[model samples]
Target: MLSDLQRETRDEEIWKIKILSEMQRLKISFYFWREKTNNNLSYTSLMGPDKLKILKEFDLSAVFQSKTRAEQIRALWNQFYKLYLLMQNKTTTKKIFCHESQAWLDAFLAPSTGHPNKNNFVRGMYRTQDVTPYIHVLVNHVGEFLEIHQEFGLAAFSCSAVEKKNHMQVCLYFQNTLKDGGHENSQKSAILEMLEHENQQLYFALNETPNFFEAPKKFRLE
Candidate 1:
């Protein structure tokens, strides 16, 4: 007969294998690390949105589930959701005052005020895992930035729109511009072609009118 501790260990190993198999089925990549002391650690290659989707999709009240396993998973998912909400709250364009900044710091650092769950989540994550440099900056310096720029929010300083525009430009350039050879043995410059295409797009945007009504609700507003 197996001892209680041995049975528990066996169950844990089985659960780990099942979870890893499920992750593989979902096309999630698992990475294993080997350090100097022969310690093996593993993590999945899930992005932020992926993590959110997984946490949101997993239901604890589903049928044929182990209660203990479900509770453990739910607790971890709640922690991740709390962190997600905290990040979403911080990344907005709404003005944050000095007091609000302090509140945000409190919610970010210690688990005593504001949203204690989010604070505890961050604190627990920091204690258990290796956080990125961005997280380090978010924990230490973002509150200061918010306090100094109380007139505007962090969205004012975001580069996401610029990055997206650059991405679109690169796609357009690749699709429309010629690489090397052109008619009359002339070497066509892709950069020049891209600029001309951009100018044409701008001209159309400025001058062209839609045949269909853009805002039918506006026509009915009288």
Candidate 2:
């Protein structure tokens, strides 16, 4: 006979496989598997949008058939989806943080008071799972940061743009700059080439004019 802990572990593994299969069927592109060399799952490609989609769409009903556990998981996911939506809030011109959303964050990070409330779901989760460092920072420090910067919202502190720029630069370097003989023939340093590429992009952007007129109706543009 299997021990209780072993059975639980087996069930969890089976559930993970089912979830992954479902996500694949749904064409969700977030990474969930461990790399060959590393035991931990790669989160480098997991962006805010991916997280929001997974939280919103990934069904926990198949994994947690128990009413109590399913309800708890749903509540937790709903809280996460709300948090992501708040973070992704944008103005007409650009991304902006809304201070009004902090109330939801506070509710999410609230301590369990032994009553039936939003905090109870998080409390139940904490009881079952180990709190990671990211969770600790989000629960404790995020609110403090928001308090310190009352004028700014969470979007102001987001690193998405920086990450995107870095990814673009890496692609440029590998595909365009370092192609022939690993940059031995080129007179310019890799850093200088990258700088030049950025300058050229900026120049083009500044020189480009916006076309205010709409395309003709019969053009059949895709």
Candidate 3:
């Protein structure tokens, strides 16, 4: 069972996924509300005025802007990535996406999709030479897509330690990226014409890729 705060976080992630799934008929507006904590560095992304309000209570300003529904889709994907990272912790420098790493995540992920694989109706898992310390980025949900939802992806990296010790340094891996809300390549006009900061989905990518570091989550970042 999730704690009260964890439950709230789950709600926040779910709402982001839902509201961003633009409906041709229902137009939804999202805003940053506030949070009870005052830790500014604890969060990666979030959507909804209520969640923003919760974040703001802790001095974290969360906001998103989009002119078209496509942008809104991107925004939703962005928030989930940020929120998940804010909640997870980094502890080891083992190969990310390796059998061991996947084991830990599978416990949490399997309930949803019967565990990821490298095929359709399933996602394949693997690592790439993205960095040193044996760092590997785990990618899942690379191809699955629904009509109105974003496909998700995950990655992990090892934190550079002080000694550069031949010994292993702990790693913080990012899990979960929402991309289905992405607009088609042909929608180039709208994407190019959209507001630069608001238009670029880079933040979407940033928030999706979880950053692991030593932090306290006692009261949701106060």
Question: Which prediction has the highest lDDT against the true structure?
Answer: 2
Question: Which 10-residue window in model 1 sums to the lowest lDDT?
Answer: 120-129
Candidate 2 lDDT tens digits, 115-153: 676545423334313455666665556555655654666
TM-score for each of the candidates: 0.34, 0.44, 0.18
> Which whole-number lDDT from 0 to 100 does residue 13 have in model 2?
62
What local distance difference test score does each model get?
0.53, 0.56, 0.33
Between candidates 1 and 3, the lDDT winner: 1
- Backbone collision tally, model 2: 0
Q: Is candidate 1 or candidate 3 better by TM-score?
A: 1
State which candidate has the highest TM-score: 2
Model 3 TM-score (2 dp): 0.18
Q: List residue ranges in candidate 3 displaced over 4 A.
A: 1-97, 112-188, 194-222
lDDT of 1 by residue, 1-222 (tens): 012223345554544555556556556665434555866544556775666666776444341144543554466556545544543455532233333444434433333224555633322111213445665565566656755664665655876788799998789777887764478577678888888877877777788943345655545555
- Per-residue lDDT, model 3, residue 204, is 58
Q: By descending TM-score, how would the candidates be arranged?
A: 2, 1, 3
lDDT of 2 at 64: 51
Q: List ranges where model 1 is wrong by over 4 Å.
A: 1-48, 51-151, 155-158, 180-185, 209-222
Better of 1 and 2 by TM-score: 2
